[model samples]
Every structure is written in C-alpha cells, then in structure tokens.
Target: MTTDALIPHATGRADDPQVRRRAARVAGIGYLAIFVLAIFANFVVRGSLVHPGDAVATAADVAASESLFRAGLAAFVVVFLVDVPIAWALYVLFRPAGRDRSLLAAWFRIVYTLMLGVAAVFMFLGLQLVTGGPGSGTMGPEAGMLMFEAFDYAWLVGLVAFGVHLVLLGRLITASGLAPTWLGWALVVAGVAYGLDTMAVTLLPDYAAIADVMLLVVALPSVVAELSFTAWLLVTGWRRPRVAAETA
Candidate 1:
C-alpha cells in the first residue's frame, strides 16, 4: 500500500499529464508484448505438452520437443523481467486519478509479478528435471509434471492479484475518463470473472464440469475488455480517448 514511498517521487508526478501519457504508451506496448509471450508460453508450448493426468505422455512430449519447452521457459523469464516496468507504467499512468488507489493497484500488480517470478522458477526447475540439468535430482515425468503444475497454480494465484488490480483500474477509469466508461465496467466484470474462476478452481474438488464454461467466462471478457483498453491507450496519444464530461 505504501508503494509511493518505494518509488522516488511517484506521487510528485501524479498531476503531470505528460508523464502519465508517456507511461500509458509504455504500458500499452508492455501489455501487448506480455500478452503475446504469455499466450505462447501457456498455450503453444505447455498447452501442447503438459497433460493433466498423464505424466508419462507429458514427459514424452516435452522430451520430444525439448527446444520448445526451453523456449517456453525463456519466455517466462522475459515476462518476469518485463512485468516490473509495466507495473510502474500502470501506476504512473493511473496515479492522476487517485494516488492511494493507484499505489495499491501497482502493489497488487507487483505482488502478481512476484508470483509470476515464482512460477517461472518452478518452470525452470521442471525444465531442468526434464532436460537432466544440474537441478535434476533423478526426477522423471512425475516430478517434472508436479513442478510444471506448481508453476500453473502459482500463476493462478498471480491472476487473483491481477484481478484485484483490474478492479482498481476499473474504478480509476470511471473516475478519471482515462478510457471509456463502458470499458471500466467491462474490466470490473472481467476482474470478477477472474477471481471467480480462480476460486472455483481452488475450492472445488471437481472442476471439470464447470471448467470449460469458466474458461469462457474468464477469456471472453479479458480478450474483449482488456484488449480494448490496451488499444485505447495505444491510440489516444495526447487526446483523451473519451471526454471527461461524457464519463458516467
């Protein structure tokens, strides 16, 4: 919550539109990049390899596509590094709306990023086990899969924090006209969906019955709402995307 104290003069720059605008651009670019990298790492690489119940096949697939798995690990590494700047960018961009709220949002995102970093560590450990690296401890697919799954669950926890961040941003957007008001509402919905899905996965012993539906619940709003916000930030430039008077 005391994030303003952590960053030098962040509060001092809150009223500066130039600073916020620049941060918005940086945030837009960072978001787009993170979006691409996360999709590749989560879907293209691990999605194709990590079988939920079949450790042996998962191992076989990863062993066959060792380089691809390694690339996924590398992508996660880059993601961890990039998330810090993006968090700062978001904080700086949104600070003008509400200093304490923006600071809290940034800290939430930073917490999420810490979880992501931990997830990446699990991913690296999984990779080392699979590839027989120094971190390997005679572990096979069972251990490897566990590490990979740990990565996933840790990432899930991060998403929970991300949901909170989105909710705060939604309020900021509605308050400040930084983006469309409808987009703020959509972000709130998306953020709630994220938290709901995380809770369902965490609390329910059997999630298969609701997993597909929950996936849609989370994915659609995120793709539409979050992407729309990012696009606005990219195109808005020095002009307001939506007039302040038009905000509801």
Candidate 2:
C-alpha cells in the first residue's frame, strides 16, 4: 500500500513538507510586517490631543483629526487586504484535510480578518465625524456613537474567531514539533487572553480600554515566541516531520 493512501491528507499541497515550511516562515514574516506597520501607524493615527474639558476649538484641531482619521482608514484597508490573504496562505500551510474542515477554517480566518478591517474603518469614520464637532456633514454625534458601537460589535466577532484560529494553530505546531512546547503554549494563551478580553469589553463598558491594553501585553510574549519559531523553521526546515504516534 502507498504511504500517501494510508496517511490522511493534512496538507493541501503534494505532501511537500519543504514548501509548507517555507510558506510558514514567509507567513511569520508577514505577521512581523503587520506588527511593524501597526506600531508605526499609531503615530500617524494619534490625532492632536482632544483636550478633555475644552470644547471643539479650532480648525487645526479638526484638520489634525481628519488627517489622523484618514490615515487610520487607509491603514485599516491595507491591514484587511493583506491579512485575509496571509491567513488563507497560512491556513493552506497547516490545514488537515478532513472533508471541508480545512476550507472552513480558512474561510473563518478570512471572514474574521475582513471583519476586523471593517471595524477599523467604522472606528475611523466615527472618530472623524465626532472630531468635526456637532453638525459636521451628514452624520451627527448620534451617528458617530452608532458607528463606534458597530465597530465594537464587529471587533468582538473578529477577536473570537482569531482566538480560535490561534489556539488550533498552537496545537498544530506542537503536534508537528515545528517549535518548542513553550511557544505552542504561548500561542494558546495569547489566543485565550484575546478571546476573553474581547468578551470582557463587550460585556463591561468599564473594561474597554483595559481589554486593548491586555491584548498588547499578551501579544508581547506571543510575538517573541513566533519569532523564535520562525528562526527554527527557517533553519531546520521541519527535519523530522513529527509522526502522529510520536506526538502522542
């Protein structure tokens, strides 16, 4: 009997472990690029300080807000467009073909990533409208508030899906022995943390900003773990593609 017929079709490719590992390494780089872009983009998206107590004062404030909002919108588009493809590519790398399960996972990742992009766009629009003061254009304060709410709702879904994907990925990585156990655990933990944070923010208004901060904390270790995994994958190239029995 052929080994191919005996083993389940996990990878979508022609069982080329080398190609998959290369894809994983490239996906890691894409993740790194995303991290860099997000961090750098923050500076441009900050917008002139909207003094707490003071009323909407000057045109410059409005101009700064508009500029920041537009930058945020543009970033959202880029992030979404880039992320969907990245997720699909990565999914292709790691999927275990059991009917359409792999396809479903890939689709969820794409949906969640796209949703996140939509959320970002909504937030940017809301911020821009609010910055325009009370009666700027068609949207008013109420509309801005609604936009924020929509953004938050959409983000909740994205985070949940993303968390699930990460947890599954961690399990896959561990089973494959592509990286250290600690790295696998880190992915699982980061995924859970983000998932929980998303839930918390949705239910508790007081913890909204706190949730965002928590995600950053979770991400720090997660990124480091990922970088380590990338290094190993690039260097070793999954030399011993761990057998199912071995993982067991």
Candidate 3:
C-alpha cells in the first residue's frame, strides 16, 4: 500500500486548519505551565530550603517550611503530567510534515517525562527524610541531602534526552513552514546548549566555578526558543500558507 493510503482519511481532524490551531493553543498553555512550575519549584522553594554543603541547615529549613517543600514537589509532578498532552499536541501539530519523525520526537519527550517522574521520587524521599518519616532517625540530615542532590542530578541527566527531542521537533517545525525559520533554528541551538552544558558539568570537575557564567550565556537563548514559540502559538496560531500537500 502507498503511504498516502496508509493514512486514515476518515479522521480528517489532523488536516483541519481549525484543529491544528487549537492544538497550537493547547501546546502554548502546556509550555507556560512547564516554565512557571519549574521556576517556582527550583528557585523559590528549593532555593530557600536547600543549602549546599550544609545539610543540617538545609534539613532544618525544610522541616520549618515543610508545606512549601511539599508544594514544590507537587509542582514537579504537575509539570511531568502536563508534558504528556504537550507531546501529543506537538505531534499532532507537526505530523503533517513527517509522521515518522513527529512520532520519534514525541517518544523522546515521553522518555524525558518518565525520567523526571523517577527524579520526583527522590525529591519526595528527601522531603520524607526532613520530616522525620520512617527511618529518619537512622538516616539523618545527610541522607536527606544526598536524596536532594540525587533529584538535581537526575533532572540534569534527563535533559540530555530532552535535547534530542528538541532537535527533532525543531527540524519538523522548520520543514513544515508552520512557524518562523528562525524559531526552529533557535530550538536547534537550544538543544546544543543543553547537551554541552550537561557534558561540561558531568565531565569537568573544575567547570563548577564557571558554570553560572556558562548557564547565563546559553540559558537565555534556550528560554527564548520555547517561550517565543509558545507565545507565537498562543497569539498568532500558525503562519499562513500551510503546506498544501499536507493540508489537502
């Protein structure tokens, strides 16, 4: 059977302009949720509670503000959940460009989501240790600190997979003419930045001193890539002159 024949004609939603537009809006909302929740969890809550190399102080802060810590963990869980529909919306939005590639990108994102779920478990365990839950007496603050660190490292490791997903998704956006060419290139650059930063932190012990500087340089572009895309999807929907072949 031909490739065109393989596609289900009965389900015309994929080709409908209105449907695609709605998907874009949903994707925009998903991206916004991710950005907001991540910042709140990482900077606001953890920033106040966690004190690197000072397990006792960190544990005490967490204990004092256990509610905030729990809230942050809940945010992380919500972020992972939001990712599921985001991936599907993206695949639906871009499947017209290339079904196989779009599917591949979705799988990469789903895997990253799963990795984050595992990381969240560590964060929850860290909270339990701080709250003096079962075995907390034997484990102590040091063990709690270790679990928090594990949570951080696990998220970093998951970013490697996220980088690959962005690269694939960027290519799809560029090829489909669904958004601006520059936006696609920005996503590609963001993917590269993510990979390079992860490697620098993992491979070079001395890289920590310069890590903040490096993050400043690369992080802005990465943020711009997703934020701009999200804003565009929410505000403008998609560019005109949709691919005739795909839309037809």
User: All predictions: root-mean-square deviation over Cα?
Assistant: 5.5, 7.7, 5.9
How well is each residue in 1-248 modelled by candidate 3, as lDDT tens digits?
Answer: 46333222325566677667656766787889999999999899988899988999999999999999999999999999999878887887787888899899999999889989999999999888877897677787899999999988888788888888999989988888877888888888888788788788899889879879878857887889988888887774444545765797
Of candidate 3, the 10-residue stretch with the lowest lDDT total is: 1-10
Compared with the true structure, model 3 gives a TM-score of 0.88
Which lDDT tens digits does candidate 1 get at residues 33-63? 9889989998999899889888889888888
| Candidate 1 local lDDT, residue 67 | 94
TM-score of 1: 0.89
Residue ranges of candidate 2 with Cα displaced over 4 Å: 1-14, 42-62, 96-105, 131-142, 145-149, 208-217, 226-248
Error in Å for residue 92 of model 3: 0.2
State the lDDT at 200 in candidate 1: 93
- In model 1, the clashing pairs are none
**Alpha carbon lDDT at 58, candidate 1:** 86
Clashing pairs in 3: none
